[model samples]
Target: MSEGVKWTVLGDDDYLEIANNGRKPVKASLRIAGDIPYYGANNVQDYVEGFTHDGEFVLIAEDGTKSVDNYSIQYAVGKFWANNHVHVIRGKSELNTKYLFYYLQTVSFIPFLSGGGRAKLTKGKLVEIPIAFPPIETQNTIVSILDSFEELSTELSTELLNRGKQNEYYRDLLLTFPEESIEV
Candidate 1:
């Protein structure tokens, strides 16, 4: 189980598919809700109605400002949709989607775009890229640790937002106080 694991192209998953290489001419009024996480080229932008794939899977941006770094690995798991500018990497039994997602982030797999322009990542290269696989238990542990860190980071962000609001309120209150009349 540890060695010679079978590797397949991402297209093997019928439900999961790569996003269109080019951006849509018009932006769709799409949004994710419920269990579906709508992913964009850069990151998870919003919640969507439904996901194209089931179970844990990885998503990579296909095109956009963030897609320039072919090696800029931005991956996420759970039910999600690969937006027009993203690539969905589904995992088989041998590989864990979360583990693959995190691993991809650490590797320089993204291809460089030329002509001093935004890089566009394609599915062909993504599927052929080599990824390291560890034991399932080990992968789970790593994912768990990362999840804990994420929770803490989120809490800190909320605290910072609250503090900012409180500061703003006090500043406004102080500014509103009438200035003492200056002697002419």
Candidate 2:
């Protein structure tokens, strides 16, 4: 929250759903190797032969582990197919889509979630979550800062993984005994 920031509910005008009519759930068995990602509650489980939406949009997991344990939020660019278990959202120009995506990640869904064992973030509950709307310039600045941090974080993670692999290779090479030293 910031000065002049207004809180408002996320409605149809603020975000648009590009998912196919009826929001059909594609079964895993029916999925085939393809170029487009088939998104579910937590992540992309498979690739489907066809795509329903194109361009950039934010995906919020409607149910499953992500809904309860980890607020599973993701961004998809280019062509993709979304099942009934995810809510596809594209923000209006006034609102930076990435800004909204980051804001939602910070939100706690526990208060809004229902259905005990398998917690769910229903459409009604999703829409009711208040959005802290800031000026476009402020939103852009926040997005830019976050984007830089994300790039740096990703680079560090990649470097760490590469180093781990390099370490493993050297360790194995140094510890190996000569064939003559081993008895058959």
Candidate 3:
């Protein structure tokens, strides 16, 4: 996508759901062909479904108990959903979702969230938020790299957990062996 292209907000597609308060909920099903990283507002609550976004996009929290200061939880695209609480964005051929997601992350757009009871993201401010899109290829490269890092991190975490369990098992086994010293 190029900067010259036109862009539109969630309202344009009728996807914008104005909440009673001033926030929206991130709720959408996403599906990526490859190792696309699926994300959610509170975290990975679910996996991608059939529909998938090819390009990059921005995800802003719309409604929730948590407070987001400037698009804190944003997701780049390989394939994912914005969910109900989040606003998914696309630049008219000019920008990809990844670029927008990254740009929003740098700022705190959620400051506008307001609602005594049920809060929601205001459509007016959301559309007005400025974003910059890098070249599509660049966005893809970045997402790919980031995905790799995320995968590695996840793997490491799992490995660490397994190690912890193994250590506990050995400790229990040694303790069961009556010969082991037991401090009074």
Candidate 4:
């Protein structure tokens, strides 16, 4: 553990799994009328009719393309519906949720993962993963820095996506020469 940090297991903390509130929504089922985000292992698959959880929480991918390799972790606020493939965790007052979210991003789940191909992060194993708990002030400071970076990242991602669309449009425009103008 780092200086002034207390090492603890997540299970021993106030974190709880609230993955079930209703039947987990499938991708197809999500297309129906809904206002809530339907969370999956790594991302929001779609919007669904109701929410299983409200307020702020951190969601870790239990198993998916990104679980073993990318260690996909997301911070969600407001109402949302999480599938069984995600592990929901809410932080205690001592431990900031954003800080936990940032800390989990640094973790490599490769060693802790199960299943040969699809890699699952079982709750049994997940709970035992050690977390370095610093004072609330330190955690909050780190969260502030990380949250700024995340905001910037989101802006860049949007810009890149828009640029890609523009590139595609220009490519299509330049390539659409008149059929009669073709030589040979």
lDDT, each prediction: 0.61, 0.80, 0.54, 0.79
TM-score of each: 0.65, 0.86, 0.55, 0.77
For 105-172, candidate 3 gives per-residue lDDT tens digits of 67665555667675666667666554444556766777678768879999999999999999999999
lDDT per residue (tens digit) for residues 75-180 in model 2: 8888888888888786777777888889988888788888988888888887788788688889899999999999999999999999999999999999999999
Better of 1 and 3 by lDDT: 1
* TM-score (C-alpha, index-matched) for candidate 2: 0.86
Candidate 1 structure quality by residue, lDDT tens digits, 27-109? 34645255666667777666667665555556665567453434545665455665676665655565667777777776564
Instruction: Give the winner by TM-score.
Output: 2
Summed backbone clashes in each candidate are: 9, 0, 31, 0
In what order do the candidates fall by lDDT, top score first?
2, 4, 1, 3
Instruction: Evaluate model 3: give its lDDT.
Output: 0.54
Model 2: which residue pairs collide?
A: none
Which 10 consecutive residues of model 1 have the lowest summed lDDT? Answer: 18-27
Worst 10 contiguous positions by lDDT, candidate 2: 14-23
Superposition-based RMSD of candidate 2 using all C-alpha atoms, in angstroms = 3.1
